[model samples]
Every structure is written in structure tokens, then in C-alpha cells.
Target: MQSVGKPTGSLDPKRHLWVLGLLAPASALLPSQLVTHTGLAFFWWIGPIIVLIVIPTLDRLIGDDGTNPRDEDYERLSNDRYYRWCTYLFLPIQLIGLIIASAMWAGDDLSLADKFGLAATLGFVSGIGINAAHELGHRVEHLERWLAKVALAQSGYGHFFVEHNRGHHVRVATPEDPASARLGESLWEFLPRSVIGGFRSAVALERERLGRLGKRWFDPRNHILQAWAMTLALFATLTLLFGPQVLPWLLLQAVIGAALLETVNYVEHYGLLRERRANGLYRRCSARDSWNSDRLVTNVFLFHLQRHSDHHANPGRRYQTLRSSAQAPQLPAGYATMIVLAAIPPLWRSVMDKRVLAHYEGDITKANVLPRKRRRLLAVRRAVA
Candidate 1:
């Protein structure tokens, strides 16, 4: 077996497999086809079933390949248009799936359960598509950035393009970073805070940028509004074409997609903190500040997002070249499993709290605790001392 740390040289062994990135959106539509032929309502939920169950199971069985590309290979891999096209393909497929879902919702034959199952299925696709957008949004290319917003339209999370690159990447793992979940914060609490705070921060960051360029805060040049306009136009056009019957389900799926995206946000930096200097500046982000998982299936599905520690260190790095870090904290499993764990607060805390505490060398003060829980954590710390 190849050592996890050893580079496999110039050729990326996984080169041809990248087309699997489209598997999520395309496979999701497959079940609806099955439903059409077999009249099985359960087919609608296949997307969620695959994400919540199959992916995690496959992750466990396949395990992490853990091949960090040789430094020499980075340029070649990053410049590979093949990988870029794989991600670019997701946008059209995702949009088509949403349209198909709308057509289904517009039909009268489906039961309410079937309707929600289909909604959830598409929600999973759109939520994962946000990961694709994250990959695209970080690039210097103009077309990729535009497609990133198009991918986000299904989730109604267009603000993510501005906030993630500017706000989350800039302040990640710090107390001021709303995207980073605190030690005592559950997925439920973190979702609304991150989602709302991110939107506000994106607007402010864009306004500040525009102001320096002599543009108004609400100027047409604000890319944040541009992204939102794409979403609004998409929803309006879909409603007009599919009729009002598809509108409510469209909104429902959007909520689920956004919720899933925020849940991943909750997982990425839970309880991690970047120390501030005496001069009041936070330390520069490094691998240790973000969670890392090398699970191969998820690394593929999410386009190497689970190699998150490297991502923070190289925010603009192409996903194809993102490396696994030996120093970064490792999750017990891939994001597929951890995301499920995060949804249940007690389970999330039970599994992750000890890791955070250990990462800080058992010093509770070093972790970012939820504000209200700090006193209680300190009391327990004193008792242990």
C-alpha cells in the first residue's frame, strides 16, 4: 500500500473519476425516473437516502486514500481544465433537476409525503452544489465566479459567494467569525446565527469595498446584490413556468439546502480558536485551526472540502490540488457521518467536545466556548484543577 504521505508523482490517479462529481445531481433525478416507471413513492427520497446513508457507509468502507499530491504536481493539477469542467457541469445539471422537481410538484398525483421526499432529495443536491460553488467562488476566473452564483441560486444562498471568501475565510476560527461554531453551540443554534450573520457581513464587506472605490453601499456594482438578483430571477421564472403549485416546495427545498450548508459551516470550525496578539489582531489561520478529514468518498463528493485545513491555508487553491495535513485535527469520520452527528446536539458534543478540549491541551479557556456556557465550563475547569 502507498503511504498516505507519499506523493504518487505527476499523474493524478483519480483524474478520470472526477466526473463522479456530477453523480449527486444526476443520480438524484434517476429516482424520479424510477418513480415514473414503478410508481414507487419511496424513489423520491433516494437522494437523501444516498447522502445520509449510502455516502457515509461508502466512506467507512472505502476509507481515506490520503495521497497528498507532490508539490511538483500541484501546478499541473490546478491548471487542469478537465477538473474545472467537472465542477462547471454541475450548474446545468442542478438547474435541470430543480426544473424537473418543479414539474413534479406541479403535478397532482403525488401524496404530501412524496412531495416532501422529492423536496429533500433536491435539497441535498442543491446543498452539495453549494460546495461546488465554494470551489468556483474562490477562483480568480470571472466565468467560474458567475457560475458559482448560478449554483447558489437553487439554495437562495447567493450571499455565500461574498461572505465565505471575504468574511469566513478572513476571520475563520476566531470568536468574531460567525461561521465558526462555538464549543457549546448546537447545529440548531449555529444555523440561524451563521446564516443571518453571514448575510449581514457580506453586505458590509461589499459596501466597504465599494466605498473605497467611491461607489455607494447599495450601488449596482455590489456583487452581493448581483448574486441575489440571479436567485430572485430564477425563483420568479420557475414560478411563472411551473405555476404557483411549485412555488412553496421551491421555497421549502431552498430552506433545506441553506440549512445543510450552514450545518457544514457548524462542523468546519467547531470550538477552534485563533489566538489574538496583545495588539488585538488574531493570528493568521493555519491547518490546526480547521478540522480535516481524509475520507475518500466525501473528499470526492465535496471536491476535497474535507481537506479543510489546507483550504484555509490556501483559500484560493483549486480543490484538485488541496492536500491533506498531518498537523490538522482529524474528524472521526467523513462529513457525511459528522453532519448527521451534528444534527443531534448531545451526540455532536459528546463526540467533538473531547477532541476540542484535547486540541487545546485540556485547557477549556483556549477553546471558543459559547458565551452563555463559559461560566459553567470555567466552574467545571476549576473543580478539575
Candidate 2:
């Protein structure tokens, strides 16, 4: 299948910046209402519907075809200036939203819908938005890296900063990587695997980083210890201000966000695998390695996250510049819809298994091609069942 081209219409960074900034205010809206009067349950749904569905639809309508591509001379702009501003501006938006939500919880009368809405906003901002920022932060610039950490801090997932860039990306699609979903693995199966695996990988990475600096796991300089300290501090602060009730809600939001991320993971590499070489190393990830989505609506809301093929091919490319590749596997729908489908395990397996088989068949037709590693994973899983 031919991959879709980059957006071809007017492309304005200002528009995206504005939309991202608006997230804080949008999230703050229902919470602000909840603090004063606890009965506006209906308004909670409004924020998510508008954010996850309505706004994305509108973005598609407007279209961000790269009509006004960044000038070649744009590289001369100080990377530090851009990174600091993005971090300083966007990071506070999430923090402000979180504060408002926590305050609302402290108030007496909160409708169930209001609580749900708060959770939804947190999930989007922290999970999807922050995660995207983390990916962007890893660009080859000092400023972007700082902004990425700020984004991660907002989500309470700061370990991702170290683990993703230094750990997950390096080990992706391998059994050792928590972020990678195995072929034929159900969404239900992928969750605990990702969560537990991710945590373990983070610890392992911290140890390695520390070992290089002549420190041990318990050393004060240990990043893993530092991450735990930060997490504990956050919990203590929330417990003191908002009471224990806030903890469950916070975890709920995080779970929702993490699950959304994993669902995307499942779709992106389902039943796809690299070939093992004579030296027992998997082939390097290429454009054809990942599933790509180019649907206009999803791409905009996700900050072009669906351009997975390009991302794997060129990890340092900016979201604005990532292109689709014909060699990559294509998703049937946007990430949001696919996420929903993935929740239904039977339906997800049925739909995706056919796609996997087809891709494998195509590979088999090529001369001198070897069986993909994903095929072995799937076969092993089936045998175990």
C-alpha cells in the first residue's frame, strides 16, 4: 500500500501552539465549575467529546497541508530559545489544570460526571499530549530535552524520559522492551506486560547509567531513587491537600492514559517482526517495520504520532516534518477508534490476525526472504494456549 503524503495545505505552527495552550483552559473549565457547585455532571462529557472527537474533526476540515513549510533558514533559529519557550509555556498549562482538578476534588459536592471528566482531561493531557511532547523533547537539542522532562513530570511519568530515549528505543520490538507489544498479544495481555516491564526496564536503565558513573542503585545519585522520591513527594502533597480520595482518581487517570498508549502500541506492530541475521541480531528497524496511519483527523490530534514509519526510520525528525511511507503497515482507522476496538479482544484479534497473515504471505512471495520474527512469537503464543 502506498503511504499518504505529508499534509499539503497551509501549515502553521502557531495554530498547533494555540491548540496545545488551550488544553489547560479546556481542562480547567469543568473543574472550575465543580469547585463552586458539584452538580454539573453533563458538562464533563463535553470536554472529552470536544477534545477527542469534535476538535480533531475540525482540524481535518481545516487541513494542515505543508503549504507553508518551514524555511531552510529556520535552522538558524536558536534551538534553546524554541525549547525553553515550549517547555515553560506548555508545562505550566498541565500543572495549572492539575491544580484546578485537585482543588475541585477538595470541594464538597462533586458529581460523578465531573470526576469522570477530570479523569478524561488528565488522561489526554498527561498521557497523549505529554507523551507526544516527550517524543519531541528527544530531538538533538538541549532545549527540547528540558521541555520533554517538564511534559513527563506533568504526567507523573518522568521515568519515561530516561527509559524511552535510552532504553525503549534501543530495545524496541525485542522481548526485553516493555513498550513493544508482541504479535497476537491481546490488549488485555499487553497492559501488565508494559507496566511491569516498563518499570523493570527503567530500573535496569538507571542502574546502567549509574554504573557508568561509578554509583550503585542505592546511591543518592541514582536516577531510579530520584524518580521514586519525586513520585512519593507528589503522592504526599496530594494526600495532604486533597485527601486519600485523590490517589485513586490519579491512578485511574494514569491507567486510562497508559492503556491508550499501549493500544496504539498493539496496533503499530501487531504481528510484524524483524528478521534475525547470521550474527543472531535482529535487523535494524526500517520504514517498513512499523504500522503507519495518515488519516487527517487522528494525525492532527496526535501531533502526527500516527506517522510511525517515519519516526522509526528517523527518530530525530520533528513531528511537523515526519512523512508517511508506502512500505509501512497501514492501520484501518485512526488511533482513537483503533484503541476502542482493541479493548474488545476477540474483535481486535479477528481483524488484526487477517492483516498479519496477509503481510506474512507477501513476505513469503519475495525471493530469498526469511520468516519474520513476529511469526515465531505468534506461533509460540498459540502453542502455549
Candidate 3:
């Protein structure tokens, strides 16, 4: 009922019920994967149907709810055990769902369509799985940090823990950040750069940390390598239990999940650049540096990740406490819908390029536009002049 982008003053702490959508993927997938074994053709399509179709449609119909938790409620809401338990419980559910999904993939009863839908479903769930990791990974508690690595291991993106924390966050919104999408770079171009560059950045960060401690790059203290070891163990165990065919499905789903992560990276800071100081260091990050979305559905499902600007500014802020700012650039749609739109390069540019241009009030040079599009953009400016 609230208008998209309009503030819905002070939210009730009880509204944490929105996170119930986090359970939807498991409910959709576990049953579908199991029921398909009974030769029910319709169940195979359920996961993709609910995630791709149902959620996105509802996101549109529901629009945004720009409600910030009242300051007095911040401590109570942030420290809520129920919120933490919701995320804590996701770890086991994610592990179990993966096992069931893998077994289903390895079974011969599933048709190609069934397997395809399952893989898409796994990818969809795994993307949210990484989001769960992202939330826990930021915490200072030992259990939460380890849980983050465990979640990342599910999608074979364990290195994300190191790169995102030590590397990407340190260099976000600058040319130095591979995870930050440059203006005019399509999602296809951004994906390889983010994925490969992000991995390399993680390795370098870990290698540096080890060097400071006079240890080898592959030292046991290296958290990045530790995460990868967990991934290898997960794959090996799954293979031994479910046969070699399950390995490909796991890998495919991992790629899909990783791509989904990079897609978020692409959209979050697209075309936003920090000011380079005379000393050559970029200005400090603020709410203005990242794109913000307040759509309630995806925000709840992803744990308020849509309020990215506040998260970037205060990395340790619990998801329940992240607030939206009117000054931060707003996305045209929630992440799920925007991610699908980002897949089509021309349509993405047509819709988003003008937004980037508008954000800077047509100061094209202020954006991180790629070299290939620079000449054309300049020509367009000249023609318009």
C-alpha cells in the first residue's frame, strides 16, 4: 500500500516477520525435488516457477516500503534473538537442501526439464545462501564468521569471505575495485571481471596477511585457503555419496550462484565514483556511493541488503538496523527484477545509462564509464549540445 520510494515513517519491531520469505526457497525446493522422484512432472517446475515468476511478480505489485526502524527501537531490534535465529537456522537447512537437491540431480527419474528447473532452483537458493553468508560474515563473533565461510562453501565461493571483507570493501566505488561495476560495462562484461578479479584480490589479500605473520601463502592461518579447503571437502563428500554426475550439477549451481552475486555487485555501485583527492586517495565512502533500494519483498528475503548504502557506511550494522537515506541513489526496481533486466545488455544500458547520467547531472567524466563507450558518449554530448 505504501508508494515506492516514499518513506513509511517508523517501522514496528514485530515486522521482522517479513524474513519468513527466506524459508520459501527451501519449502519450494525440498518438496519439489522429493516429489519429482515420485514421477510428478509439475513439482519439478515449482522451484523456478515460484522464485522466478511468483516472487518477481509480487515484488512489482508490492512495490517499496521505505520504512526505517525508529532510533529507540534500534538496539532492541538489532539484538533480537529471533532475527539471529532465522539466519542461524538457514545454515542447516541450506546444507540439507543441497544434499536432497544433489541426490535428486543424481537420480535418473528426473527429466532434463526437471534437472534444469532444479539447477535453476538451486542457483536461486544458493544466491540467497551467499546473502546469508554476507550477513554473518560481517559479524565479529567467531561462530558467525565461521558460519559465513560454511555458507560460502555451499556455492564454492569461499574466497568471497576474504575478498569482500579485506579487498572489495576497502576499494569499493573506485577503479581499483573489481567488484564495482564501471559505467557502460554490461553485466556480461562485468561478470568475468568481478569473478576473476575478485578471486585474485582475495588471494593477494590472504598472501599479504600471511606474509605479515612470516607464514607461507598456503599456511593454515590463511582464511581464504581455509574456505577453499572446505569447498573441496564439500564437493568430495557430495561426490562420494551421490556419484560423479552430482559434481557437475554442484558446479553449475555454484556458477549460477556466483553469477548472481556478481550481478548484485554490478547493480549496487553501478556508475557511482568517489572523488579522487589531490593526494590521489579517493574520498571516504558515504551513503551516496552505492545504489539503494527499499522494496520490502527482496529487502526482507535478502536481509535488508537492498539498503546497501547504509550497510556500506556502517559495515557492522545488523540487517534489521540498516536504514534508508533519501540522498542515496535509488534503483528502479528491487534486485530480483533488476538482475533479470541486467541480463539484456542493450535494454540495460538504455534504461540505466540515462539514470547514471542523471545521477551526475550529465557530467559523464565523473562516472567510471569504460573506454569503449567514452567516445560515443562524448559524441552524443556534442550532438545534444
Candidate 4:
């Protein structure tokens, strides 16, 4: 057994195998049934209980085998083909869950709380699970990319395909990036900014991308426009077929999913900054640039999204094979706990600001100044008050 924050070079094979054993079946079954079986309050309780008790305990109890990072097995598993297959498996499973959820919502037998719970569950799974698909979607394969878009569409966030790859990636962890939460910004504050800001940026980026190819902003070939249209069409179809009631439920699900996605963005780089050179260019991103989480449970459920530092460094890496980096910023807790903590702005700042300080202890040049900027901004607002 090892401590939660203990440093180990490679993943714990026992923990990894346990995750593979538990998660693959749970992922397949949970989202589909949680919503569909409205009579079962037990299902909802079961998941949170497992997450809180079983996963965390396993994380602590499992010991790591010291495998060298340079091992051929690690190298082979980390390659593109593994990730591509993972992407293929992800899409159909998600679509089936969404369809089952929608069917449950269409039925009149379900209670209000059941409906709300279903929407919430759908939002979590769609936002987190499907967002993983979007990450894989931007890679150099056509099938994987298409599957990613389909997963995004199920969540009604298909524009992420356009925005995240072409827009957000290029501007990540910068002031210009909406998805990048600024220092001292609460999760509540970051939500509107990320959603509205990401949407606007995606449109702007689409126009720019199209212009380069001598296409108009509203051109049918523009993916941003196409995605937006598809999203609206899906909403319209849901509203028409299932009646207007389903529209609110769908929107609620979308909002929940979007909030979860933004909260993730908030945690990943929070206050991290890249230095601008005298020539007014920021330093290029490296493996050390983003926060990484290697907790076995979270990694399997989120498709190794916690290996964010690697993803940022090598944006094309598939989720299955993303590796934990020695130099990356690490999270104290899993994404679920982190999301809850981020809701309280001052607490999040108090905790994460210390992390920023620790990560930059020796080097002032590497300090993320966004927290300072936020402090100054807050002081000015208080003075006006």
C-alpha cells in the first residue's frame, strides 16, 4: 500500500488492473441504467458510495511495482493505435446511454426527482465521458475524429470539436483562453466565462480558419456553424418529438455537462503561466505545463484525462496511453473532490494559491502572476465598494 500523494515512476499494475476490471463494466452499465431505472434510488447511492469508499481505499491499499519508464511495454501501450481503438469503443457506448436516457425521460412514469437525477447523471457522464471523446477526436485519424464529434453531439456540445482543437488548444493557459480559468476566479465565475467565451472564440476562430481558405464566415463548410446548427437541430427534434418538457431537461443536462467541463478547465492550469519573451511571444508548452492526476480510479473513469500535462505537451496522444509526467503539477484529490472544492472561491484560492507558491518556490520567473492580478482586481473592487 502507498499514500495517495506518494511519488512513483510508473503506474501501480494492481491498481491499474483493478480499475480495468471494475471501470469497464461500471462505465458500460451505470449511465445507461441510472437514468432508465427510475424506481431504483439504490443505483444513484451506489455510485457515489463506490467513488467515496471503494475507489479511494483501493488507491491507498494498492502498492506500485517499480517499472522503468523506458520499458517497451509502456512505450507500446502509449502509442496512437491503442488510443484510436479506445476512441472507437467510447462513441457507441455513449450513444446507447444517451438514447436510453432520452427514452426514460420520454416516459410519463418517472417522478420529478428521478428526472432531475437522470439529467444530472447524463450531464456528468456526457460532459466527462464525451469530453474525453472530444480530446481524442482532434487527432490525425478521420474515424476517431468523427466518433469524437458524435460523442460531443450527444452532449449538445459539438462546438467543442471546433473550439477546443482549433481555438482553445492554441490559446490555452493564456489570458486569451476562455477555457483557462484566471487566478482567484471561482468556478461559478469561470462557468459563464468559459461557456460564452468559448462559444465566441470558436466562432471567431472558425471565421479565421475559413478566411484562410477563402471561405465565408457562414459557409456550410465552416465547422463552427455546422456544429451550432446541428446542436440546435437536435434540441428542436427533442422538443418536437418529446414535447417542450424535454427541451428544458435537455438544456439542464447541457448546462450541467458544460459546468463540469469548465470546472475541469479551472483545475487543470488554474494560475499557471508561460513567460513572454522580449519579442512578445509566450514560451512554448512542455510536459510540465499542466496539472496531472494519476489516481487509478479517476484515470479510468475520465479516460486518463488527469494525465493532462502529457496531453497538453503532446495534444495528439490518445487518452488510453497518456502517461503521468514527473514534472507536471499534481492534484491533491480526484476530479470529483476538486470540483466540490472549486465551488468555494476563497477556499479554492487559499488552497490552490499555496500549491502555486509551492510549485514556484525556488523560481520567481516561473511564478503564475494571475493570482496576483486577481488580488489587485479584487482590492480595486472593494475600494469602490
Candidate 5:
């Protein structure tokens, strides 16, 4: 395999920009350094600031990037070790940030507001770390799969490794999938369902799989157990090193981080559903079922996770090789903007409900919808018709 990462006739112009992804984990350290020198408390919240404000603005100014490699270029791009290092480097830097944050949280001379800001910073990093984990988790390599769980440890969402690849991918875009958002479902309403539902689904899936492998539910071979064990070990070590005072900040950051990931989930497949077959099985997922964005800045920051339509269509494809499909539904803005919108239910419905309805040609029945709101929505449509 000759180097496809760089060649005179290389296809990917943004290959060097992939390094921008390090900004996410590096955020925890950068803000801390800035605050240390400048004494500006606002810098403590840099991670969220980068996400909520910076990325969205950049998406507007920089605009979309629909570039995709040729089909013939897929294998070389996918196996490029350079791309693998980008994700592999994330885990260690992420852990280093958490350790530094823990030390600061335990004894730093920061005010309460500043401490919370630091926690939010760490939370955003941990949350984004899950996206990195997601890309790795889809790979067939044993090391990448294990690295996915390690990346998830800071957020206490190690079960995501078990649930997302095994559970969410299979059931996505269905009423039965907890991760898929329904029409008229608020983000607040979807949060607990996705969280608890994902956990329960992972447990059940692991139990069933272990039964076949002649292993107990508690067996270390269970991926969920293994992932959670890493989280437990991480937490215990942090507590011992930094003292119990760091625990609350750790927990706060984990919650914030998990929420960040879930907000992405809420935005990704909101009101999108797969059609069922005559045999009662759902149709295989296509790009049509997931919302997509091609904002160059966000795509680079997120490791092309925003090119989600192609991701579901090719789960094992590296982010470098994931293509944007014309068949997929498009989001009005990058996920950074959408995640903020998802938090405000009324505003969210105003922007997204019509889009959902249009996707199914105004047929509410075709959309995955909230059962309680179904009748009212249908009635409104009929009266307007």
C-alpha cells in the first residue's frame, strides 16, 4: 500500500485539516492554561464555548463541504495509519485532561462558578470522546474496539460500546429503537428513554450473547462488563489520587458529557424511520433514514461524524472514507447549532417538525411519532387539508 494520505494526485484536500479534531480533547488543557496565565474565569468554559458558539459561526462563514473520495480510493484511505493515529491519540490526551481537571477540582483556588466551568469543559471533552469511540468501535480491529471502551471511561458510558454498535445500529430509525427520536418528542423527553433504554438494551443483548458463549452475565468477556470495569477503575483511581472532593466534579462532567452525546443522538435521527417489510422486519438502513450535515468546520472537528448518513450506510468505514450521500436528508445547520435547538422543545418543533413532515410528504403516519400527540397532529393536518 503506497501512501494515499499524500500524493501529487491525492483526492482529499482536507486531509491535513483532520488534525483539527484534537481541539476537542485539547480544550480541557488549553482553557486551563489560558486561565492560569490570564486569570480569566470565562476561559474555564472554553469547551462549551467552542461547541455552541465557535463551530456554528464557522459553519456559517466557511459553508458546506460535499467532497467524497472516489470508490476506488476507499481502501487506501481507510487503511491509512495516519487517520488511525488521529483517533488513537485522542484517548490519552482525554485522560490527561481529566486527570488535570480532577486535580484542579480537588484543590485549585477557583471559585464555585469557575469549578463548574472546568467541569463543563471536561464534560464536553468526554462527550466528544464518545464520538471518537464510536468511529473506533465500528472498526473490526480488536485494538480499536477496546480503545473505544477506554475513550468512554471518563463519561461512565462504557456501555455505549456494547449498545451503539450492537444495539442502536440494528434498531436505528425504528419506533423500537430508543436512540431514534420520534416526531413531537422533546429532547428532554427523549433523554431518559435513550439513556435508560440504551443501558437496558445493552444488558439484555450481552446476556443473550453470553448465553451462547457459555459465559455468565458477570463474565469479564462481556464487553459491557469490561467497559464498565474500566470506568469503575478509572473513577476509583481518580478518587484515591485527588481525594473525594473531586468526585462531584467528576460526576458532573460525566453527566454533562453523556448529555452532549445524547443531544447528538437526538439531532441525528430525529423523526426518521425505516419502513417495515412484508415479513415484519425493518428495511435495512439507508442514507435516507439519518439526517446529514456537510459543514466543513464541524465535520473536521467531529471526525466526519456529521456525515452520518454515510456512517449508518457503512458502519465499518473509517471517518476518512465515509462519504456524503445525495439521498440523505439534510440538516439546516451543523450539529453544533442543532444540539442547542433540540434543548428548547417549542423552538425545536417549530424548526424540525415541518422538516420531518416534509420528509414523509406530510403523512404523519409515515414518521415515527409520539403516541400521545399522534391524534392531535393528524387532526390538524386534516383540517388544514
Candidate 6:
């Protein structure tokens, strides 16, 4: 929980920048070729094998970067063209990767196992596709924002462009925020609420924006609709070019991508709440409101997204400049590890509930417990007392 003034790491981020591109070809080439050449079906599970198994293992082995960049270095880091181009390169790589994977699906003579491998690998692309979009979506430039939509179009979840920036960031950690997971709610229960509810929130947010402009909900300037329209167009073209066989992979990959995003949302503020004053206004978000991780490998791949507190507090800051905080609720492991652990409700609850309680000093009611679990949580608190 100790805070460092600057980020510390031995890895030269400039040299390892290509690590972000590793995901581009994961689905497009690696798995199927490895399977076909080796004649082993084990490679079929490479997607989960890489995301759930490999990354988490490496995260533990390599540990985290805890030091912040020096105060003087912030200006140079912020102005670095290398970091900007890294995100800009995302558009072609993911777009081409998707096309290549679809071509493989259409032309390759492969087994169901091969198809599954492709879908899973593409799912990882879908997940990282949105991750890249997230970094760009926070930018103010018109081109960067358009590229955000394009990146999201790859995953068919373009509404995130609107909802995340306008809604989730504004209402986060409140009961009203779909992206914020409630305590005692399992990941299974949270996923549908977050996905379906998040989309609805996006539309509502768009309606409100258009209303302010004296435009109808269907106005072309309605960013939510515009983003979705782009997604529909892309999907239509992909289906037309690749035929129906590609539909299942496309849909499954989108689902995996969305699920991955919601899982991250679930952990970022699970059981945390912003205090409301007697006047009925919640306190502004701070480091304490969100969970943070500093694991180095995943942080680099994710563009330092694990530094959630700073990102939320200063959404305009470039990822390369995001700093770690001492006050935020710290995760026991890196994001990849936490995301996997979240899939199992019992283990997730067992591991995280105690931390939540400790954060609140055993005051159960001060935290955001699920409605159904309130009485039980209170009873447990009394028993412990």
C-alpha cells in the first residue's frame, strides 16, 4: 500500500513496446499453424492457454513495477510520439487480423477443434481490441475518437465509446452504475446486468445529449447510434464477404470480448462506494474508490490500465503517464489473474470479501453489498463483533 512518487522498472518500455502487438497475430496465425504443423490438438486451447494460463504465470514470475517516473520526466513521457503511435498502429493490425482470421475460417480445411482455437484466439483479439479502443477513446482529438469507434467496431461493442466516457465514469461505484459490481453478486449474475444495462445506459445517455442539442434521438450526430451504425456496417460487410460460417465465430468473439470488458469492470469497483453527504451528493471519486494493480507485464500489454485510480481521476492523461496510488484498494494479483479468479464465484468471494471488510474496518453496511446478501452480511458482522 506504500506509494512511490515515480514508476520503477528495469524493463525498457521503449524496447518492449512491440509486446502490445503480440496479440495481433495470436488468432490470425499462431494457433492453427502450430496445431497443423505439430499435429497436436493441445494447441487448440491456445487462447485460454495464453490469457488464463500463460500471462498470469508470467505475471507472478516477473512481479510488478512500483516506482513512478520522476516529476521532471512526466512532460517528456506525455509528449512521447512512440506511445501515441503504438495506439495509432492498433487500427490496421486489428482490422487486418480480423480479415485474416475470417479468411482462415472460410478457406482453411480445419476440424471443429481448429475452429474453436480460432474463435478463442480471436476472442483475445476482441478483448485487446477494446482495450486499445479504451486508451484511444479517452483522447480528445477527432481522429483518435473515430479510431476508438473503429477499434470497438472490431468487437461489435461500439456503444462503449459513449457509455464508458459519459456514463460509467460519471456514475461509477454507485448502485446506478451497471459497470460497478455489487458485493455478494457473483460474476455470472453481474455479467448480464453489466452488459444489457450498460447498453441501455448508453442509449439513455445519448438521448440526453441529443436532447440538449435540440436534436432527436435518431440524429446522425448521436454518437451512440453512429458508433453502432459503424459496427452494423462492418458486421454486414464481413458476413457478406465471408458467408454465414463466419457468423458464429464473429458473435462468439464479440461475446468473449464484451465479457472480458465486463469482468474488468466488475473487479475495478467491486463492493466499493463513494460516500454520500447529508445533502444527497456523493463525494468525488478518488484513489480509494477503485481497485489497482501494478503488475508489470500485464500493465505494459494493457497500456497501464491496471492503474485504474489515476485513469479514472484524470481520464485525459495518456496511459504512459498513468501513475500508481497508495490509497486505492489493491488487488492481490495482476488483472489477468484477477479476471480468471472472478469467474469462480466462491473463490472470488472468499478471497475478496475479507479484503472489502478490512477496507471498511468490518463495517459491512458502509460497503455496497447486494440487496439479497445484506441481511446475511450484517449477521456475519454481528457474529464477528
What Cα-based lDDT does every candidate model obtain? 0.88, 0.63, 0.82, 0.65, 0.90, 0.82
lDDT of 1 by residue, 1-385 (tens): 1123447764787777778879988865787789889988788898888888999999989988667788888888888799999999998889888988888899987889999999999999989999999999999899999999989999889889999999999999988988999999999899889988998999899888998999996778888888889889999999999898898998898898898899998999999998888998988999989998888888888898888999998887898888877778888898999999998999999999999998899999989999999999999989998
TM match of model 2 to true structure: 0.79
Residues 1-385 of candidate 5 have per-residue lDDT tens digits of: 0011122246677899998899899999887789879988899999999999999999989988757787778888877899999999999899999999988888858889999999999999999999999999998999999999999999999889989988999999998899999999999999999999999999999999999999899787989888889999999999999899999999999999999999999999999989889999999999989999888899999999988998998888889987777778888999999999998999999999998888888888889988889899989999989
TM-score of each predicted structure versus truth: 0.97, 0.79, 0.93, 0.82, 0.96, 0.94
Candidate 4, position 177, lDDT: 79
RMSD of 3: 2.4
TM-score, cand. 3 vs. native: 0.93
lDDT for each residue of candidate 4 in 1-385, tens digit (9 for 90 to 100): 1122333344334334423523422442574465456745655434344544565566545422222233344556556354455545665665565556667688887778767766776676666655655666667867666666666665677778888888877877777778877666778877888889988877778888899999988788877556567668767876677677687778887777777788888899887776677999977777656776666666666666767887888886655545666677777766656766788888788778767656776333355445547567456546755
Q: Cα miss at 301, model 5 (Å)?
A: 0.8
TM-score of 1: 0.97
In model 6, which regions exceed 4 Å deviation?
1-15, 18-27
- What is the model-wide C-alpha lDDT for candidate 2? 0.63
Candidate 4: 10-residue stretch with minimal lDDT: 63-72
| Candidate 1 residue pairs that clash | none
Error of 3 at 155 (Å): 0.8
Write down the worst ten-residue block by lDDT for model 3: 1-10
TM-score of 6: 0.94
Scored by Cα lDDT, where does model 5 land? 0.90
Candidate 4 structure lDDT: 0.65
Candidate 3 ranges with C-alpha deviation above 4 Å: 1-14, 24-28, 31-42
Candidate order (lDDT) = 5, 1, 3, 6, 4, 2
| Model 5 stretches with alpha carbons more than 4 Å out | 1-9
Q: Per the 3 Å backbone cut-off, how many clashing residue pairs does candidate 3 have?
A: 0
**Per-structure clash totals for the candidates:** 0, 5, 0, 0, 0, 7
TM-score-better candidate, 3 vs 6: 6
